[model samples]
Target: MASEPESDAFHEAVPLAELEAEGRALVAVEGVPVALFHHEGEIRAVNNRCPHMGFPLTEGSVDEGVLTCHWHHARFELSCGDTFDPWADDVDTYPTEVREGVVHVNPTPRRSDPPAVHWRERLDDGLEQNLRLVLAKSAVALQDVGVDPAETVETGVLFGTRYREGGWSSGLTILVALANRLDDLDDEDRKRALYQGLTEVTSDCADQPPKFDQEEFAARDVPFERLESWFRENVEVRDADGAERTLRTAVAAGATPEQLTGMLVAAATDHRYLDTGHTFDYVNKATEALDLIGWDHEAAADVLASLVRGLASADRAEERSSWRQPVDLAAMCDETFDRLDDLVAEGEGKEWKRPDGFTDRLHAADPEEVFDALEGAIEDGATVEQLARAVAYAAGRRVALFATNNEFSDWNTVHHTFTFANAVHRAAQRTETTELYRGVFDAAVNVYLDRFLNTPPAPEPSPDPDADPDEELEGLLTCFETQGRVNRAGAHAAHYLDGGGDPERLKAELGSALVREDTGFHTFQAYEAACRQFDLREDAAERRDLLVAAARYLSAHYPTRREREGTFSIAARLLDGERVHGADAGSDAEVATGDD
Candidate 1:
């Protein structure tokens, strides 16, 4: 028999005789399955769920003062429930006592600190151990307390930068990409978004050797001009160490964010749309990470050093025949790049009045005509950001109108142009450097070159005023479940946007749809680029186009094997303390698969 305690929290666990005779008992405390142990002349209670996979703890053996789970051999110090195996994590132990021949246990475990504070520490632990469950738990709790999402992003940024000798990685890039799109998602999805990004970053740094620090030159008095030249020179020759040192020196000399951006943007363009424009996009993302993490010398050094490898090792577009054979586009760029400075001087501090119907002209098939159009705009005093935005929108159109007849992999071709244009747009906004004008022109040329991919473009979808927004969105996601639904998916999302549907809901749904699939780095880049460009566009038609581009791209890649997301789901369930295994869970089990 069991007796109740005066405090509601202390539920009568079991009779002293009953618990002692068996040495352990399973009881429900506050509906949480709890395991009670009579060991080492003491009575102890812990949650019956195993911290690793939710195995039944009462069914396991107890020796001395330690409790061992038979499922995974996870050993816990029964008194405090601290696990000897860190991967299992510490279990929650309840306050226990014996009164009047009856055992009593508090359903509410003792707490020495606030959840926000504790989880904040746990976030570091999760990152340290690359433990997805701990990261998910900390993210959920921290978001509940309204902790700024940037703080969590910063943790990943620092960890990612320090652990991988490669410096910045696609992991950090993906993390910052989601961080960029956070506000576009619904409140709850924001937490899930951060968790997803953090998990990727963790996976990136796991088991990798730590990065060695790069010190700046002893003289902080060096001029930015000299350092910029040195940095570009080193990158031009693929000298990674020299480039990193030069960049660190610039940071130490108090280079403004714009100045630093100018250096990378200039170097990225020094090689004719370096690496099919990924070089520029990565520069923009690394710059964005600085926005979330910080721009101080220490933060700058840790994050920016990775770019040396990215830039020094990146494939130069001019080296590829594709840029040369058809249009001699690289030669055309070289001709303009020679006088690029003069052209930039003409455009500085002047208002850009787009020539009539100029947007349509940017995608003109004649490479010469495209160059003339861009030079016309630049010579008319189009600002760098203005040029970037124009080029990005044109690139967006390239994607929005991307043809389905093309082989599936070619989706990346137009995507490359659009995302590169978007990066140039973002970086252009950050600096007044004329160097990005070359980046802008480079993007436009790529867009023009990519026009073939979208030739005889798919008929654009229009808003159906009568269609239900919710149903349309649901159908939009459903498009991913089947094969070759690319164009139809685009139509669904575009129509939903113009039909007075909530953009945030669409974005959240789109984001959820993306994270659900086994997506890759470029997929993330495409999704975020669309969201960002969507934010920058005021034209109703353009907004609709951005949505269409993202939907088409995601549809093209959707319903992946999804094995990766499944892992994250199980980890999330464990963090929520759900019993995933053991007899108490029974044959009928609801598998948890992420933040729902």
Candidate 2:
């Protein structure tokens, strides 16, 4: 076999005599250690470090052109550095030539794919195999080559939506959520966010089978209204296949993005607070993911398909005791929904003015009054986004006013309502549909249902507190080191905003606080929602309040035992080319050899 071509610039490695005497010799080319081997009448140079765990490969045994790592028993071909085990990954290979009795090796590895292409393939492999380390490496590698991180988000969104048979998982939601925040994050956190989202995507697709896609209608003349009607009807009957085909049919009919979103919005709200408002949230996020990456109709269909399954079978909150007992929020919503079209029409072009005491009525105990109040807002010309924002603020109050006496599990109830409301508000921005109005109401009612959580509302932090912003921020982070101080945490975030401190710094700090913890799905949701709501508001008070709510929520759940954090830390250190295994942790991965 002929040797593959390599870069002409070769570094003098070691004398061929020395390499031949020991059968192999490890030499540094620039800063990297390359192992030169004489085997089967050929001299081969490969990266000395095992790609899997960074173990030195020079000590491993080679036979019949195969180099096997003694640690993991992973075998690779010496000539091309292709691994026999997929989990081990391929090692790097360098072209070598004998020059004046010395072995000269090209430091650059001869690869079939460029860095971007190889890392992309590795990313797919990582996703397929649920390998976080490989995913991390790929993230760093791709970014190093100036490839936009959003591309990875796109890759994950497609993979997750296509592979998860049960429909859109929370992993997809996290991916979309983090994608929205990527631009605001710094480099390291950007990578952290990417790793977190992609890792969740990998976990979600693990062992899950791909969905069978439904093609567009053979005839493309079906009207949008008819297809939408067919879609909702099938969804109501829990016929996923029929609903999917109808959805695809609508897409094929050249339905606008708004029309497609309207279809999901209507179906998702058909039941009272479906899946506790998560159904609409996922629909909105799926749409947002499409927004982040330019919508390809086929890709859009795959993303939406995940949501169609959820809409078809999501749990209706009407079935839950809390929504029905004492006060039937479901009935109120039904009455309000019946008149939604007229209300939306009655308010059209009205130039919305926020009614005095509007939010107060929303937070009040009576569901009927709340519906009436929201109806009045629509009637008074409040836009879809306007209504959604007010509703989201109410949800934020649920967390901001959360009573510490409640069980830790109860925190999720407020968290869920707030995140859902924020997601609905985001959807409203994409399309102005009467259906999303139901989501706004659903969120308000959820906040109402959670009223008991704020029975004795934690006092709202005084705006413009007479305190140093720097001290407050430092103190807030310190609380994360200790046990529950949720109320105090909220105050600090408020003070930071009130004191006119750097809003970017506060966001960055809160973001760091979020990722450092061993967290769950809800935490990511809460952080993203708070940041989102903060950005949407122009009022200084509202923005501060949102971050206050976020700080409290994060503090309530901070300081986890961090079992996974250890593994992530190790992977990060390894990526930085640091030794993490033992006393030689300060040094890079290398094999011991006598000085040449």
Q: Name the best candidate (by lDDT).
A: 2
Each candidate structure's count of clashing pairs: 1, 0
Q: Taking the tens digit of each residue's C-alpha lDDT, what string does model 2 give over 415-509?
A: 88998898888888878877888888888888888889999888988776577889999989987877888888998888877777888788888
**lDDT for each of the candidates?**
0.82, 0.83
Model 1 lDDT per residue over 462-495, tens place: 6677777878898898999998898899989977
TM-score of each: 0.91, 0.94
Best by TM-score: 2
State the lDDT at 167 in candidate 2: 83
As a TM-score, model 1 comes out at: 0.91
RMSD of each: 4.4, 2.5
| 162: Cα error in model 1, Å | 0.8
Candidate 2 Cα deviation (angstroms), residue 326? 1.5
